[model samples]
Target chain A: MNRKISIRMSGLGGQGVVTAAHILGVATTLEGLVSTVNPFFGAEKRLAPAESYVRISSSQIDERGEVLYPNIIMIFHPHVITLGKCYTMPFFDGLQPEGILIINSEQPLDLSKEDLTKLGQLNARLFYLPATQIATQVAETELSTNIAMLGGLVGVTRLVSVEAIRESLAERFGGRKFLASATTAALDDVLKSKFAQVTQLVDRNMEVVHKASEAVQEYFIKKKEAGSLCMLR
Target chain B: MIEQKIVEPEYLFFQADREEVFITGSEALKEAIKRANVDMAISYPITPQSESMHLVGDLYVEGYVREYFRGENEFAVMSAVAGASMGGVRVFTATGGPGTLRAFEIFPAWAGARVPVVCAFMTRGVNSPLSIQPDTIEMAFMLHTGIVMFHAETAQDLYDMLLKAFVIAEKPDVHIPVGVFADGFFVTHTREKVKIDPAEIKLPPYNPYSSPVPVMDMENVPVRHMRDPFVMKSNFISYAAHASWQQEILAAAERARKHIHKYLGGLVETENEEAEILIIASGTAVSQSREAIALACQEGLNAGLVKIKSIRPFPEEEIRKLTQKAKAVIVPEFNRVGWLCKEIKSVVEDNTKVVGGPRVFGGMTMPPHLILAEIRRCSQ
Candidate 1:
């Protein structure tokens, strides 16, 4: 693993993109690493385009605001790519060479030939997961889709320990109230009401995470003489 | 809530053991106030500033703060905060962007009244077409409000400055309002790691007896004997009285310089001061400058940095001496007005050497590459 990693998470406002970045940031800090997280500055409305940046390093992080050059990009919804519901143009702008891309989709979405060529030039690695499906199936609620995406992140990178992620989940949901925004707070209530207890909420989310981690599949893109070919891993 | 013991300011600030916490800047503000032993806190909601005050309200609920309430508006909140301060209590309040301008009239009143109030200004863009994004143009308006000003660069600075502001504002010679300004969203919403002193120990309560003015308490007899009322008087006596009092307020901030040095270490912190190329900034602009300097260093260019912590005092002497030897001085700012550059220009001998910006306003983050371009340009 690299000494430092910068991640950009893009999704709709209600999809818990900010929460995923926050939980991952906290988990990194819990592992005694440094991390900073911030959500995009905009009017946060349900289903509106939302993005978040998370920087995790073994040392200090001096930068703030959006991660312009991200080593990893997580698309929380297909709309971010398909419908162009993304802040950055082409949904993968500023992706570093050999960067990692994780998309929450049951199957691969079609990428433009130009984008495929660009990714091939950068030697980027890509993965896909049915995170929302996993969330509804395992946790019985779609709110855990963010957790499932995080599980996919762990399965791919192992950036943070599962123990640290569990503790961060407990601290976020069970400890003192955390407010990313008024809208996020209201969403938290809806998520909490779906469970019987705080522990149950944590446990169910963990189950979603584990299932999604196991379900995540990677795509190996081979640049052939004729065209680019993507094979499921 | 755990029982807290009153400790001396120095011990609480420097001697106490600390623990690291992964939290947003708002949580850091709450952590600072939790150990500040505040008597009262008033609230008004504004973007980027609301969360910090909400956390303070949590402190009130946890019994760390003695009194807390939501005011009718920003003006009402500032007025009520002033009233509470004059009543011999350590009062704290916060406002930003439109809220800061809405409550603008009370800032000078707090200073003139000589009430040791600590207000956190989470600066954002004031409305023209209405922007809720982070901007520091509000700090430019706050420069001459007769209050002491401290600009924080990061969450750690926000936490440290807010805690020390109480001690700085309450000095007998100072006894004035202190506004700790942090760039909104950048320092308010961004989650970062901050080291904080233990919550079991707190700074000793504010002592109103140390105030230069009479406390507005029941124990003191009320007196309203003036030979002439200044309100309607268009005479020399009235003008002279008001003029001298304004001078006194400015002098009070000057008196705070020594206290700032004692508590905050210095008005301006310098790094690699001997380098020919220099970057000078305040607030989050300083953080951007640090990154730019590192990039410049990697490119075989030597550039130093001057981070202005105390903006009101202006650090004129230090800035003058620092910029005198530098070949070029780069001033990166979060606002379009370049108020910080103007301050540096006013002090530096060769104002031509000071580059006014790689400025970005309207809530956009100052990318380090932009500042690096300036550094590379100046290196030529």
Candidate 2:
């Protein structure tokens, strides 16, 4: 019955993972929800690994510690999968049965059915997006992939309003000349695109966040019926 | 002077009668600032000194105090406070060890211009094998920068010292900045009881010399220009300007010394009626020496302690007169062999003997008992 969404964004430094988390924090606050975003980095010089977290809740947050569990995990770099091994596993263990995992990979690798049974042991949903490809197509740089992932995040969680997310992106990146327009276009393009197997991307991503709010309402109903107890696996 | 009511809250007591309640030096600072009605505090979180900032941030958000939380780095935080102080507002910032080292450049700019900026410096060791512990090396290093430095020992002293720093630094004569230095792990994190009575403590009137009002005349403006170094040339004008800057520094130091004496009445007192040996100490060392002096008295050593309350002027005259009759003068500081001890030896003349006590390791508390032991050895 608790409607709390914890988001962890992981990637190499300078990929805007921290920036993405902050934007999400501002967007969630704009929705009148209680939210907090704390960035964690070790030797955060450019090209080094960095991770940040965003926690949003309909009620007050009493636990002021690192997010041990997360409802949504957004991975920005494909190579981070190896670097983030120890860090990622704990967050995966924290996911709820109906929680969603979104990874940014150039080539989608299906979980072996046996491994899938073990991975889906928690009954959580999983999806992968070639956001780097989308970023190259739109921004002509891998940097905008974070923007593409932000769009894909909206597609999966629907926890934030799409309009609010757009405003947050503009506020964060709106001042840069070429980067701004390209990032905005990238976010817009991803939200509107349809994938043959990625029906959730088209249907859930483009509902203009206010309408997206209804999808969250439906997802919670299914979640409650399944009785997804809020416990770290 | 402004008169405000000081509510004697149940928690603000020197000794807590109740077993359930207690507070740390860091928590005491937070409580004192809240009690003092501070408007804004900006600081980046660093170990041995982060609690004060964290408490202020939490209080600001909870509406217990009004403040602006800014920046995740110390450089941005100190710069923000410097800008805020220039706008004629009461502001405070804190850091320790390397954090203080990072902000060293801005210190002279703030002090030379005589900004009544108050900062709490938690002393930590420098470089290489970095530590988040306590020490006095940082304070000793910053001694010559002309900032009024106060060394505090107990939780009560920390509270009183912070309150006194604002009053002393704000006076026009002593408008040169102020810093309250406490040992990092020893005092910054240690818990103790502090009696907070704002009424008992009176803050001096705000007589700022450089407040927004432009007091200098434009018609009599002095102009000095520098030739480009690339040109490799100089003239009478450049030489005169350089000379004038040096003169101004001397004049500022004079004015700062006079003002500090006037503002710090009993706080920086002198007692030389009858004593053979004079001991010079400040901050936690003063408290340690006080205990050592008591032990020296028991051992029948004719010693008197003259704790340096205001360290900017160095209180040269009082220190010289007090030590005139002493057989030997001993100075025990937390810093390694440099700065303060050297300055004391430079100022005190005709002393038959002068001994610099052993250096206590940085980031760790040197027990008063150990200081007493050192005084006994020096007396022998």
Candidate 3:
């Protein structure tokens, strides 16, 4: 909701971390906001650590390269923290006060007492979702976990509208650029694939996104209801 | 009175039929080439500079480009491109860093022959130990290449400059090669909003008849008596002939200045005019300087920026005029050699006031904070 919001997303190579950042950028732009998605430099290989920075703003953005101070962080894979697979030391380093941290895990993070204390000192908000599980169940592909995480991001941050993201998905898969008839045909082609067409894929992904987003809202609401002494589970 | 040669670019930002799109610098250059109705694009792939050519290849497939191919190497690519340009078609080719050096020998000849070709040089560190990262040391060698140069600050600038490059290079008075330069990865990979003219209304094709010297062809004209070079006995004539040709190349580049100002608005772009501390930079370094100046202004530091968009003409007049009243000129560059700084000091008076080398090379970033520190130091 600020003029600018910087998010750092970390995961292994080939996990679609860059694509997620790109989708976020496209969504932000469609929402009449500006955004830049920067993938890590150098040649990235499968299983190697990869990270991307996405900066969305209502005004112009001139900053280039990595995001040093992020208002939000998305852990596309738990290994980014456990295996120390990131350019930034400690992975969560330089997280701003009251920052939002979203982890793609089925349960709470295995952070040490010191790390937890640091997060508490910063008053950071934390959330987790079984992204891979959700992707596998809905899209029948773990690769779609990034999409689920994006859904989770929108649900939690409410920074961009869901309508904008749907339009982004249509623009991306519909091959709709430059022509109106092509947009309709492309949407039909995508939705009519063996997975059905592009529209079917987009609609299915949107469903997963909606569910993941709702789950985050419900989980956080329940946590607050249980008070400050709530269990990690 | 100031000459009335240049006009503000605001009027042409998004012309009536134009569209605004978000794309990488590489893609922006490709769009410019497409709109310019380029005849040929011969290239060999290298990091950071590769995508521009790939998009050109797409244009070829889309029937917008007449000819496109990948050469065996940069040398072959430039040779093919020069050959095509001399054959009287508007041609383009791109190389970066080591690739630039691999093809460096052909550049001067491209200008000398007055081919009016355009080449994109995406700045990268030449290989010592094999660095594919962004660096501007490659620019140091190009300053003497007899080619006109345009160093872009952002994706939009890259788009605008590449389009202008074709028009500038093909001018009858300016039949010289133009090198459109942008930093590797930094600008090439950074996606930003760019406004471009629609395809239908782009610049017209290169007219070979417009060239001062004719395109290479031997058939039509009757063979006449051999020129005086055959009877020349002294090395003096040879040297004089070569010397005058070199002077002609320089003259051509000089002629390009008016066109550059007309097309690019001016060779040097300034921001925050009254600041005492002046930051002189080009390409991606200019982007960092903009941020640094903003930060300095927030803290009440009197600072401004003079970004060199045209590196070949050197913007000497503008730099001289701008730095006349400034207390100190700080030059931030991405290359360790600080070629831009050296050029600035070479032109501007009070060399002691000009400080260069708050630099980062080998793909490392030159953050605004680093430049801010230099501004703070100079303010004292």
DockQ agreement of candidate 2 with the native complex = 0.01
Residue A105 in candidate 2, Cα distance off native in Å: 54
lDDT of 3 by residue, B1-380 (tens): 11122222333333435677877788788777777777888879988788788888878887778899999999899989888887789998888999999888988888888888889899899958888888989899999989999998888888888877887898899989999998887788776677777655446667787888877755334344466652346687787888898999999899888888787888988888668899999988888888788788788898988889999977888998999988999999999888998899988888789988689888877778889999999998
How well is each residue in B267-347 modelled by candidate 2, as lDDT tens digits? 355444356666677666665576567667777866677777666656777777777777777777776754667777877
Q: How does chain B score by TM in each prediction?
A: 0.98, 0.79, 0.93
lDDT string, candidate 1, A1-233, tens digits: 33569999999999999999989999999998889999887777999999999999887778787788899999999999999998788667789999999999998888777777788788898899999999999898888999999999999987998888999999999986765687899899999999999999999999888888888888877777313556575
Error of 2 at B99 (Å): 0.8
Q: Arrange candidates by TM-score, highest first: which order?
A: 1, 3, 2
By summed lDDT, which 10 consecutive residues of candidate 2 chain B come out lowest?
A: B13-22
User: DockQ for all models, in order?
Assistant: 0.70, 0.01, 0.31
Candidate 2 deviant stretches above 4 angstroms: A1-233, B1-22, B35-37, B62-65, B198-263, B266-273
Error of 3 at B378 (Å): 2.5
TM-score of candidate 2 relative to the true fold:
0.53
What is the number of backbone collisions in each predicted candidate, taken in the order shown?
0, 6, 10
TM-scores for chain A, candidates in order? 0.96, 0.68, 0.85
List RMSD in Å for every model shown.
1.8, 17.3, 5.7
Candidate 3 lDDT over A11-126, as tens digits, reads 98767787677678888887888888777666667778888888888887876767777899999898888878877887667898988988898876666665666676777888
Better of 2 and 3 by lDDT: 3
